[model samples]
Target: MSLIAWAIGLALLLIFIFALLSPFEALGWWAGWGKRGLEPSPPSDEEMAEAQETVAPYYIVYLTAIGGVSAEDISKRERVFLARLKEALPDAMIVTDVFPFSVTNNPLNGERLLGWLWRRIHQSRMKRSLKGTLFGSLIFLRNLLQVAVSADPRYGPINNVGVANEIAKSLVRHGYPLGSGAPIVVMGWSGGGQIAVGVARYLNQGLNAPVYVVSIGGVLTDDPAVAYVRRLLHIQGSKDKFPSIGDILYPGRWRIVPHSAWNRALAAGKIITVDPGPMIHTGRGDYFDYRATLANGQTHVERIVELIADFIRPIQDVAQPA
Candidate 1:
């Protein structure tokens, strides 16, 4: 074989090896071997009491991209998007924590082993070092594997529950009305889309509340969580093609498979798809780029934030306190 062919083959082999080893972290967490985050816990008495009182109009838990290292480690565009979203929905509680890739919600640079390496990679990324992108791929691939675990029937149940616990804890921590039948909208970007949908079933029952999922170019599997989600809005851009990877990888997402959960949700009108003009998955002209201007004269992030805010806005008065 040619030298280039040999190199390509080696790369594929390494990726396969990485995939094979990806589930160990989550497995260790479940087996009580990892020390980053605790197992799922029920709501406290105080949290239950807080659930009864009046709360924010609605909740929005924003899940970051797979490139994310920690809850707080987000891109400048993402931070700007969250800030803009908060301004757009001042009455709604917007949550930016809850590392979507970790079943225990443990960040890459958290208490887990090999954290020092991840910390350095995160720092390098902040400095915009080329080496950061090189090292960040490892984190990206790690989270990507977790996404696959969430979609795999063999591991999804155990994994999804752990992630759901994290989301539940975040909501309760932020004073979400648990038993109040209030609504939560999970705005998941990229890989987070799958996670946002994956945890819907548990979140729905855990808090006795409704859950909505808004996927911004999310890679989703045909998990049963789709059935439990109150509503799912899949917003994609015409120029983006990465989202199609999910469709290609998961047979259940294929149109020919009429019986899959994703298809069923589509048939029942539980899933809504929107294409907000031209954009790509990431980088220069990606959806959240602050400098990427659309034909309508709106920045990429502005248009998307508006769409998200309008979709989840409530009818009742959602004004701020005096």
Candidate 2:
């Protein structure tokens, strides 16, 4: 065979092997590869200033969990948690918006040749044994490719920790520190909690403010991406199995173990753990409701509110002149 024909055959063989191991559908869903709508820009300067004045003492940037699509898509439990936040922090301003960060809705479409190959990979069980070996290799390759193409995963489930810092810079440009030098609270439930970790990392890198982070049920890990966000607080219920088990999220790995370790390391520093008591073993999506129960059931929201209030008061008190 000619050198050109041999090269062509070799290329085809490699592609066939890859398809057997990892299908495009699974790869796309996991990595969030390809195009997605851009995130909406931050509130305008005028709107931001108004929000600053209205949301004095604190400004909150809330990111939703995986596949959230928009803030309106948040679960009933989250709505409940936000309601509690509104009542508890009457003086603070809360800006809630949903961000689109994943590309799972559409099927994969590459070059026509690759597309047909992908279809075959999806259709064949004969490829199973080959798939078992290729699966791991393909996933690693795809993940690397996706990360190389975008700072955040193409899946758009978790907040892109890197992009989240840009949002914070925008906040600062719009005078977020305010005259009070008030603290900024970057809050998220599940996927959003991952963004909160990103935000803390962002702050630690350049902009340092008294930002108190709260992850309802975020995956915690020892990865360097989360190293800077040391000042974090995580709340998980006893019943929520999610805190212990990983999800089929964009990044694949969950943040629970990292959170547990973080809590242990910070045990001597500023970490504080708050348990909402037994409810169900759902996950962070259930935080708002579980917390709602704590708020209105027996202890009432005030008790928990007070705990948060106490956590934040010291900063405000320290800012005040004697």
Candidate 3:
């Protein structure tokens, strides 16, 4: 064989091997390999003492989207939304401890590598036009693989269990005992909304406490957990395409014949859906953007925060001072 032919054959073989092994590597990372350091540790004595002293009427657990936890990881809209939430509920303690389930921080993970490559390619000015088409394709493939692997019954349960336990531990570490009767609110964005539902269920079943869930432009599936939640508020942007992906990826969410658990929940008023028109999937178009005007002559951020405060105030025994 010619030297060029041998080189070509060897390159093809290596590519094939990588393609096969990449999924396994991604799956392994999802299964919690090399991620221990990122996990939240138990709160210290001082932290627990502080928590006990300033225990608020409600606890707000904020779960970020893919690759989002810190301010740097999130967009300006998310940061603003969080700030407004805190401002609106002065008595509630906001917990930003939940980590992203996917392999976002790990530089060595195969999924992260793929994401890095895609970002690099999409960012180049030469490929600006191609970026939208190619990047969307890459994202679709990534989301599909993630749903196929991580959304399954076997592997998916582990993530919820871990997150639930972390939440419980965090409560205990912060001096909130199990079954403390303190109301817990979970706010999840994008994919984190799925995790919030799972965590709510676990908290209800395992800890004997129900939690209020707020899904902001998040994709959701029907889970028995909805039965155990105190209330579920799903805020979807009219222009947001990300949340609709759940319908495509998980058809059961939209099925009418054999009503999915989510459908049933909606029917029973256990879940409430809010459509804030003209909002996009991310950034300034989300619920947080002060620039986005609402029909009521208030900014989108202002109106949404008002809605949230109204929803939460009635649930709490001690209301915030007007």
Candidate 4:
């Protein structure tokens, strides 16, 4: 055989091996590989300013979706929602970008890819295995390269730990009474919701502080850390189908026989589900557009913020002194 033929055969063989190993890779992430970490840094000046305005009875740390890297990337609609949330909860500081650092520079961040593929599979109405296979392959390639470079896996529980540490340091720096039993709300949208669960678990274990998690259109998978949260509020739009993809991929949340972890959380009153009838997965039309509002009295964004404010007030009130 010619050299080119040998190279082609080798490439095909690798592809076949990758396909066979893909599912195992996806499962392995949850089982083990998604546990690497990076060192945490003190909250930056901007982060401090964002969270310092009012030392409210409750501290809210808002984690954005997968592509939301910085506050500057937040859209006008989102800004409006944030402003309304601030007005309604004047005593609280709604901190965004709680995790300011990206785990790896790899364009193929596995967690983000999982979210994207899950959404696509759902939107296309394809079978769940399609998402599993594609996500498995993507994660395999991503981790394979990371291992090749002797670098840590960028998207995993360890990233959650780093972000949680930063949040803890910020609360301490701002004098938020970490172990004083103050209410800590970790709110996340899309993939951030998964991170929120990890952060909640970290705070509960490391600081022994109770945490409340609010997931808005979030894609979630089973994580042992979820049990650490005192309460979980899941807000989903009736029209939004993307967030449910996690349930399909992982067989929890919406399953007929819910996963044991989720079932236990629900039974223990650690989970609450809310469906806002008029909302969609993202901005105005498609995902991430954020240009227009739904026809309801308020935009979907506004409504979500309003709902969050309403749900958190009682918790905050209970924490406040008479």
After superposing candidate 2, which stretches have Cα over 4 Å from the reference?
1-55, 98-161, 169-175, 178-181, 225-227, 246-264, 281-285, 290-296, 299-307, 319-322
Ranking by lDDT: 1, 3, 4, 2
lDDT at position 97, candidate 1 = 83
Off by over 4 Å in 4: 1-54, 100-155, 252-259, 285-296
TM-score for predicted model 3 compared with the true structure:
0.71
Clashing residue pairs in candidate 1 are none
| lDDT (10s digit) by residue, model 2, range 85-140 | 77766655565652412222222223333546434443342255666435334332
- Give the alpha carbon lDDT tens digit for every residue of 168-245 in model 3: 665655445545667788888777777778678777766665589988887776555666688898888778888877
- lDDT (Cα, 0-100) at 233 in candidate 3: 87
Candidate 4 lDDT at 101 equals 33
- In the range 129-149, model 1's lDDT, one tens digit per residue, is 787776677788888988999
Model 2 TM: 0.54
In model 3, what lDDT does residue 298 have? Answer: 85
Which candidate ranks first by lDDT, i.e. highest? Answer: 1
TM-score of each: 0.90, 0.54, 0.71, 0.65
Give the winner by TM-score.
1
Q: How many clashing residue pairs, candidate 3?
A: 0
lDDT of predicted model 3:
0.64
What are the RMSDs of all candidates, in order?
A: 3.2, 11.6, 6.5, 9.4
